[model samples]
Target: MFIREITHWFARRSFQNRIFLLILFTSTIVMLAITWYLTDITKERLHYQVGQRALIQAMQISAMPELVEAVEAHDLPRIKALIDPMRSFSDATYITVGNEKGQRLYHVNPNEIGKYMEGGDSDDALYNAKSYVSVRKGSLGSSLRGKSPIQDSTGKVIGIVSVGYTLEQLESWLNLQISSLLFPMALLLLVLLYCARRFSLHIKKQMLNMEPQQLSQLLIQQSVLFESVFEGLIAIDSQHRITAINQTARRLLNLSQPESELIGYAIHHIVLPEAFFYDAPQKNKKDEIVTFNQMKVIASRMAVIIDNQPQGWVISFRNKDDINTLSLQLSQVRQYADNLRAVQHEHRNLISTIAGLLFLKRYDNALALIQQQSESHQKVLDFISHNFRDHHLAGLLIGKYYRAKELGLELIFDPSSFVEHLPSSLSHNEWISIVGNLLDNAYNTTLLNREGSRQIECLINSEGNEVIIEVADQGCGIDENIRQHIFERGVTTHNNGDHGIGLWLVHSYVKQANGDIIVDNNNPFGTIFTLYIPFTREE
Candidate 1:
């Protein structure tokens, strides 16, 4: 349970903190293990080295003629004399000479001379004529001892020569070895820990100091939001190849099929302008209309920057259908507001005129004037409402009527103008675009004409799956040269820097609906634009 708790606590730490702790723990364990291993090896190697030296000394002393002669003569003093020089050179703690019967003949400690040796290794050297090394307790305490045979001329062992190092002496040498090994090992471990800490800090900075779990959760949320967005989103690499695309993007780009996957595909092949993917300057483009698969979309693009350099581009877009729908709704609201303002202004003037007439005791005049004005207004409203059966179309005409009057311009409907129960192929929004722009254009043109000629005429009729519309204005007619590009965008007679997008929009809508438009400017009075839009919707 304690171990499990430690693991859980460590997992909760930030990435850099965990890394630092991990490196410190592992290095400590490894260094400690190495220290232990080296210490053990040093002890064993030093013991072996001391044993070999002692064995060599013992062998040399055993083969000495002085020692052999002394042992044959039983001269203990001479045996001690011969062995003393070799034993002092070998650094052994104690040296002894023993007879075949285990009687100590010569000893470093004189009290032990002529006494029986207690160790078994010295007996093995004498009786078996063998060299032996072992650790045993002796007069000098626990010691590493080596024994060699003292043989006679007949090759039979006569005695034994023994050399031993006391445990205290071995320990002094082992301690020195351990100090030497530990100093360098400790230095290396310190250096390793310092480097590990530096590396951990670097990693922490790169990871924004966030924990792995936090980063993982953020990634999951980003993925969910990206996929769930309604706007089409696409990410492209510097090479202009598609890197990422959301589901909405796939549908908008017509990549719904399995084989139509856009990942790794070049953006050029996808039909967007190359300028949109250019790498220079890394500026963003917003709300740019681009056509793909006969569908219009408003696209926005921004460069993805990393470390102050451009990595890729991200493009997002919305379908033009939705954009147009919103635009139509706003247009309808604005039109109603304009009409309301105009009605309010006109009613205020009429009320003031009636009040003045009634205050002067001209009751009959005020009543007759009110009846005339009401009948005139009701007649026009009834005619438009009865002829144009669609409520939206009727509303648009009513709004336009008041709007024209507000500008002090007479708006006249052709006597033959009539439309009833149009099919669904002609959307209400499309009708607004067609009727609104045409009437607006005519009104603006008439504003340029003389006061007497400030009049706009509108005509509308339906004929078997088709609708015909005509708007004529008694304004200055168009120039023959201007007629050629009059329907193009940015071509305008207005010098106020306003573009001529109205006609272009009308032309585009007519062509998109598979309709036709004819401009008649041959008349000296004004220009007349006639349009025929089919009621059959394009598939």
Candidate 2:
């Protein structure tokens, strides 16, 4: 339970604090262990050195000829006189001279003279003439003593010499050594703690000061957002190596390799055109058309910046075909709105005319006008509905008829025109773009000639192996110089910027369906557009 509490406490701290505490704890443990080991070693060495010094001093006193002769003659005064000066000059706490009978003849204390050695440890030195060091309690109480035997001319042991250092004195010396060592050890520990703190702070800064859990959650959210975008996205490092690529990018690029295999590959190794990589790093480029894997795309390049520093680039793109489809759909909606407005205006005019005839009491004329208007609208609706099976195509023609009437031009469908169904070779929208753009072009062109027939003719036939559409308008003919490039983007007879895309889209869709288009000069004046598309049965 205590350990669990400690773990919880540690876990509650901030990341930087936790790192600091862990480092400090580990370093402190290591330093303490080293200090303890050194202290033990120092203590043992100090004791060994002290004992050796005492032994050497005892040996020197025992070897003195005058001390040995005095002990042999059993002369207490001579022994005391010979040892006093030596004892006063030495570091040993006490020195004593003892006869062969284990009775002290000379001592640092006068009372200790003539007394038997209190430690009873002089047997070996007095009888066997051995010199050694020992820890024993004597008149001076617990001391480390070195004893040496005195020998006469015959080599017989005559007396003993003892040199002693008290435990108190040894302890004082050890304390002095330890105090010197401790100061540096404490300084080293403080330095280690300071370094650990700096290291922890550095680590925290690198992590952006966020916890690990927060970073993990952020990563998960970013991954979801990165993959959820509709546009294809790719990120590359400064070295032009792929760092990240979304699934949409892989699909758009027609790459079958897994994302894991694509990462770290050089960006140039992918199927992007050279233009995407050139002048890409120095500045951002947007909405530039470039071919990727042989497919044209509207792409944008942006530099990835962090902390006001350039890291790499992020490129986003979408297929141009997708953009064209969206544009076509929006155009169709606008056309529908325009047709509704025209129908409303035409009805309002008819209503006002009928009301005026009623006010004048001309009932027969009002009835005739109503019948004529109904028949005209019903005839065109019936023709479109009965001939074109696809509702979208029928509706498009009906809307175009109303739009043409509003523009003061006649929109006539060829009597021989019949369309059962569009083939599966092209989407309905593509077919719509082709047929709608042609009729719209005819409408615009015929309106240019105020003195002409002001009529546009359309023919759609799908009864054979191919689908054929022809639109002829009695308007100014196409210019000889620009007829060749009329299908190219940004080529238009009108001065408006928006006038060029319709024909280009029509040409693009036709080519994508593997179809052919022919432009011809109509008789007298105007232009004719004919499209032939091969039909394939839907599986």
Candidate 3:
């Protein structure tokens, strides 16, 4: 019952204890597995090395001239002194010699000393023997044997040099290796178990001290609550000094950080392009402090509505880029709607002309006119069906296509280079921005150019798994003064209503697709915009 109670207490501990336990189990399992494998490899290597040493010792001792002479002389003392050190072998224990009568001259121990070495082909055999080279041992053991003999000057075998050792040495060495391997691993297991327990305890303490609800609340407040429930803020005071700031106010004025050399500096001095600040609001109503273009924005100020006016003038003026984007999107929608109205108007006019021709008794001519209209209309409808139908980015591309046409510029989609089942990583928005912005820029440049040909070419080709797109135009190639700044946001050569937004959008889309874009004036070939898009998202 006491053990059960302790188990229940452990189960009731915080979630982090469970995580730490999991880490401990997995890490220890992996570490011990690797340790065991390394131990086995070490043991095998040790046994191999010891076995080789025993074999070489046997060969070297047998090859000695004195040991050979002792065998030939049948001298027991000399033979015993030569090889008496290695007598513990359970399987192979034999030293042999061969004389001219095929009788043993001598051996190490008296049990086998002076025994005949038998069952070999010729008496000259032992003279030709080599070290660690095995031959059939016919005297005592069936094991492999090494033989080296003493020889006279006439190449006659004086006697045999014989030594025998079994694989029992390899077995004994393996046992010793196992002992050496197991001891260190057993000690490591003890230390590692203690480490796992201590690690779990430390992790449990840190988890017990944590409060997740409070941390989540902090992130929530930073993202959501801080924007609304605070000060009525204005970045500049009545005299245009950098008097007050909030999160939104600081963002509005583009304040620098770290060593803010421009702090307490005039707001107008730091804002981009000196022209924007002249029309900035002064002292106005509490709600209508700063006018970003025509949109009224309440500036950030101190928290109060006192003296029938703000206690202090705080304003939130925004950059003009937002205003321009909002306006352009609105214009695109409105202008596209207008173009549809015009298409409907043309259809009505065509119907009316055919009806009036029939009434004026020009039936044949009316029929011919109807056939011509049908062919032309069918061609356009077929083009739309073939090029855009079922395409993932069709709706997106069509919007920009119509917008380009509405601007008195042509968007020429190449007839021969249409693709189907496009790469899945290229999102709908990305395709739209890539195709739309490039086409829009080319159209704008073509309109601006006074050249003979006014054309904007949009080509898309899929090669293997990659997509290559090029947008070009016969516009007077980008002027040198602004060529370096063409793709940068808010930098423009001519800014009427098209406020330098397209090329930056193009740059962003290419980067998002894991791609690159090269902008080059085509010398005598116009402006060529190339985009290389990869087929996959590695991350």
lDDT tens digits by residue: candidate 3, 1-539: 99999778767765566656666667678767877787678656754554355455555655577766675676757766655554444233565555545566555445554456654633444545433435453645454455554555455556655555544554565566666767766677667767767777765564454545555677577546535644323445444565544555445554544224544766666544333333434333222223332333333323233445433344445443454467457755764685576455656778899999999999998999999978965664466457654353455455545555456565667775555645655445446556766766676667777763655777676645777788888766777888787776666656586667767667755665568888777655478999888788442
Q: Cα RMSD (Å) per model? A: 10.9, 11.8, 28.3
Model 2 scores a C-alpha lDDT of 0.87
Estimated TM-score per prediction?
0.56, 0.56, 0.37
lDDT of candidate 1 over 69-128, digit per residue (tens): 898888877876777776667678988888888788877788888788775556577667
Q: How much is the lDDT of residue 259 in candidate 2?
A: 87
Worst 10 residues of 3 by lDDT: 280-289
| Residue 514 alpha-carbon offset, candidate 1, angstroms | 24
Q: Where does candidate 2 stray beyond 4 Å?
A: 118-128, 231-245, 250-539
Instruction: Give residue 513's error in model 1 in angstroms.
Output: 20
TM-score of 3: 0.37
Better of 2 and 3 by lDDT: 2
Clashes (candidate 1): 0
Poorly placed runs, candidate 3 (over 4 Å): 1-342, 345-366, 387-392, 396-410, 422-426, 522-525, 537-539
